[model samples]
Target: MQNPAIPPLASEFSDLPATASHGPLRIEYRWVNETAATAPIAVFLHEGLGSIAMWRDWPQTLCERLGMRGLVYSRPGYGLSTPREHDVKWPVDFMTAQARDILPALLDALDIGMQERTRMWVIGHSDGGSIALLYAAQHPDELAGAVAIAPHVFVEDISVESIAQTKQLYETTDLRNKLGRYHADVDSAFYGWNDIWLNPAFRTWSIVGELDTIQQPLLAVQGHDDNYGTMAQIDTIGERVPHAQLVKLDACGHSPHRDAPDALNEAIATFIKSPSKAPTSTPARSPK
Candidate 1:
């Protein structure tokens, strides 16, 4: 696909300084709150190809609504952050790398650990949703709650097929150009996510078993028309995690925050502001 001209609004976060590298990559992030207020800290994790700028003002809006602090950043290989130089693909163990290595390194670098002094709330979308799930499952003690939008608990055939189609779009259409506006180097962000999800070894991936380990409160959401994943993704989460809540929005696509911002904001604010106690059992499925 021919690259598109960078959008005028694309450089909104260009001036934000990058944090010193605690690992091989230098992390870039934007903080909405400087004061150590009583409101919980909500960390916003973008989608596979998403960056701080691509998120627009959703994080800030949510933070203001809930009177909470917001932290937004791009993953190592995406957005304005450092990119991997090799042609290596994202391995089947990508989730493990994120859960055990990248996330901790970023948190430590930012001096934001799971210590009780800081109660953290994770809001992750798409691939980020999976990362949040992994983090919450591994360190349930560190998080107050998690909200995963369009999370994939298992590698479904449909997901692989969709990714394959995306590869074709990247090659034959202007998809690359559109992505370039959100990422400094679209290829690094694109292929790092694309190649890994479509890898043959990724077919055997499943985090369903790990869901049982997540003792913290969880809100699993998906759009009825989400092209990237199906209701089964969120369903499996509720089935395995007794305390999990499921919400499906109608007329919504893969990107709920973009397609249905009002509904998404309401759902998140409600979940985040609610009492920390987990429900006795899974809430009844409410599919919009």
Candidate 2:
């Protein structure tokens, strides 16, 4: 497919200094604070093929609605961030790397400590949603709430089939071109994600068990028409996580932020603003 003719927004923030490294990559992020009162911060993690520019005005709108600060950034090899030097496929532990390594480095680089009083809310989509869940599962005390859109907690045949079709589309159709506009090194971002999800080893991947470890409030949203993943993904999340709430949007797709922005925004705002259960004295274990 030919690259879509969408106008690119001007870079919102000039290069803030690069934070610490994660293996071979240096992490970078932009922080937008609408007030100095120190309200909760909503960290926006984009989808596999998404960049800060791709999020357009949604982050700002959400931040304004909640009267909070917003943090938005492209992962390694996406958007204006550093790109990998070689064509490397994402490993089976890609989500682990993101949760345990990249995310902490970025938060530290931006001076957002896990113990900060200002509550942290994560808004992640697709692959980002999985990463967010992993992080919340691992560090429940650090986050106030999380909203995941079309998150995949368990591998499904349908997801792999859809990804295979996407690969074919990228090769034969205008998909790659459209993706190129968002990613500086489109192939790196595209293949890094596409290859990992389609890999045979990834088929057995399931983080549903880990959801039980997450004590923070969670909201999982899925569109009925999502071409890439089924509602079973979020259903599994809710089943394992006691505080998880699931919302299904009719006629919505993988990208609910784009397909059903109004519903998505409302769902997220409510999730974040709602009162959370009292923290437990002991951390929970992963479900069997």
Candidate 3:
């Protein structure tokens, strides 16, 4: 069964010109709750391995709950977006590049001018979550608020270990094949994320210093039992951004939207309507 009031998610593509550093990018983005009257835009950025399809109906449901229009998009090399070359490697600053370059460019190509951006909100998960933090730091004036779920502001041993296990699964199991369902080039997406994270040089990666520059209200969520990152991620966010709200969830893991959608939804809605730069009425779970 489905609710008629919920707007069905639909996707569109745009061909963006090449940058001096990278080649052309064809971005795939979807609209959530399109039937609703004009409202704030909630932009969703997916996990490293995630794509537009990986989000399923969560974006639509979240947008419906908040009476906002949603925009969920796959970064280059994910979903139906342009794929990365098989031999090329992602730089350590890949996530930074996305927040600093790709996001702004994508919005520009979509005709979402600078003025329209001020009212928009960004909700990002995992790697996307990190990018959201960077985006806020990069474009502080353009966003109303941001939600970062299970975001990694720095490298950790647990993250490296978990990613190593996933890489092994990709080699020895059907993980690659399964990922193929969501990524046009699963290798491109997976390897791009994996190789960079596992790189020894990335061990010192940290966004904590950069977080202090973000001027918008932020909601950072994390699961107590997450294997990929610890509470330090979101906690540090609040420490850096004085107005940032921290939500720590119980009986949850890396993905909050999947593990506790109702609670996460309520918490987010409460934060958005709270009318102040303060703590959330409730807490958080996982986001996928």
Strongest candidate by lDDT:
3
TM-score for each prediction?
0.86, 0.86, 0.93
lDDT digits (tens) for residues 186-247 of candidate 3: 88889999999999999998988999999988888888888999988887887788778888
Model 2: lowest-lDDT 10 consecutive positions: 279-288
Best of the two (2, 3) by lDDT: 3
**Predicted candidate 2 versus true structure: per-residue lDDT over 98-128, tens digit per residue:** 7877877667766787665238888899989
lDDT of 3 at 167: 98
Question: Candidates sorted by lDDT, descending order?
Answer: 3, 1, 2
Clashes of each: 1, 3, 7
TM-score of model number 3: 0.93
Tell me how candidate 3 scores on lDDT. Answer: 0.86
Winner on TM-score (2 vs 3): 3
Ranking 1 against 3 by TM-score, winner: 3
| Candidate 1 structure quality by residue, lDDT tens digits, 167-217 | 999989999888888776789888888888887888889888889999877
